[model samples]
Target: MPAESQRLYERIAQKLANDISRGQYKIGQRLPSERELAQTFSVSRPTVREAIIALELDRLVEVRVGSGVYVTNTEPPGGKAGATDIGPFELLEARRSIEGEACALAATRIDDAQLAELNALLTEMRTENEKDVMLSEDADRRFHETIAAATQNSGMIAAVKMLWDARTRSPQSRSLSAKVRATGVKPRIDEHTAILKALRQRDPEGARAAMREHLTRVIDALLKATEVQELERARQQIAEQRKRYAASQ
Candidate 1:
């Protein structure tokens, strides 16, 4: 296929996948007909079908015969908020910038009621993490979200939530997370504690530093995982080529 046509299909697929991740199309929800999609995207029916095929490869949606296409439980394929193709690294960089400011603002504004609730969430996270690491991480998300909420800025809250959403929706982000999970690396409770401590002291600089440090650690971990992923890919390619050579002989 020509590169231009392939890119168009990929662009369409990424747009649709972004909508699905944002809950415009719920799981099990049927997508518009190909004819409708083509019209909406200003493309041909064949182009829409190709986009659907790409999404299907990611397991983000299922196409049924004589019925319709529907969303699946799998996360979407790309990050489309800032740039055409935002990778996980870029998304995290954006978060570290925005969320550090959010934490700083939250320190000045958080109330006692909110502080107590945050503490409760941290406790729950620690308990659940002890039981099952992945399942417990929902609290980790909520913890950051709550900090954004304390800032009392709806835009900041939305921005933070969108970043978290992309972490799952983007294939590169998911792959990095999966690699880290395979290594049994769980969330660091001490890090969350540091952020909370800063918040409790009503120290904006401390809170900012803590949040920045936490995300920096996350970026480091992801970098390490990506290196491992690349190494494993090289190993697999070598193995496949050796098999082909032996078979030819």
Candidate 2:
């Protein structure tokens, strides 16, 4: 894909790769901190994280937890990082929009059988979360798929399925998801329960809001999960300074 058409993270990845190839970041050397990279690229920390994951996928870098990203190779073995896959945050935003509408439609169209299925899936999700939080993703996927099916629209079902497939197939997205899961962030049963309640009540707007809220929280969770520990503490200190300034004023 052309640089102009590429996602922000992909573009950043390409730039970083070029720098690496030029020996700006020699093999075995630690790259700048995530905070520094974000400022240098004028992008968010999460976008920088996505770029780092792309580099990792291309075998150009390695991420060490609680340390920093390191240059593993001067050039990507595949010649370039995976640029075609959607970014994790981008996918979540798309889901928030598409699935919110699908849930709204399902509110009116869902039957008792589908509702029963969704309820069962909710139970499964809760149980899996209790057993091992990471294990709930499968049931979570089914829960959304079931909601899409309840819409009774083939197009909606396909669209939802495509999004889920993208989540699985995108190397960058999958890496980021794995990172998030490693941080102990699992599917929120209460959020799913709220959606089910709205659906059972046959409330379209309520369902839409519930779904959107759920996905919005998911986005927030991803951002938090990917944050570097030092950067998080820095952010907390900044917040405290701002509070103090406000009190002084």
lDDT of each: 0.77, 0.89
Clashing pairs in 2: none
What does candidate 2's lDDT look like per residue over 1-249, in tens digits? 777888998899999999999999999998888888999999988788778888888999988776678899998787655556788888888999999999999999999999999999999988898787656999999999999999999999999999999998888887887788788898998999999999999999999999999999998898878865444566788999999999999
The candidate maximizing lDDT is: 2
- What does candidate 1 score on TM? 0.59
Residue-level lDDT tens digits of model 1 in 1-249: 344744566688878987988999999998887767888999865456556656765778876544578898448444322223345566777889999999999999999988998899889888987787677668888899999999999999999999998876766556556656766676788888999999999999999999999988987775554331113345688999999999999
TM-score of each: 0.59, 0.85
RMSD of 1: 12.4
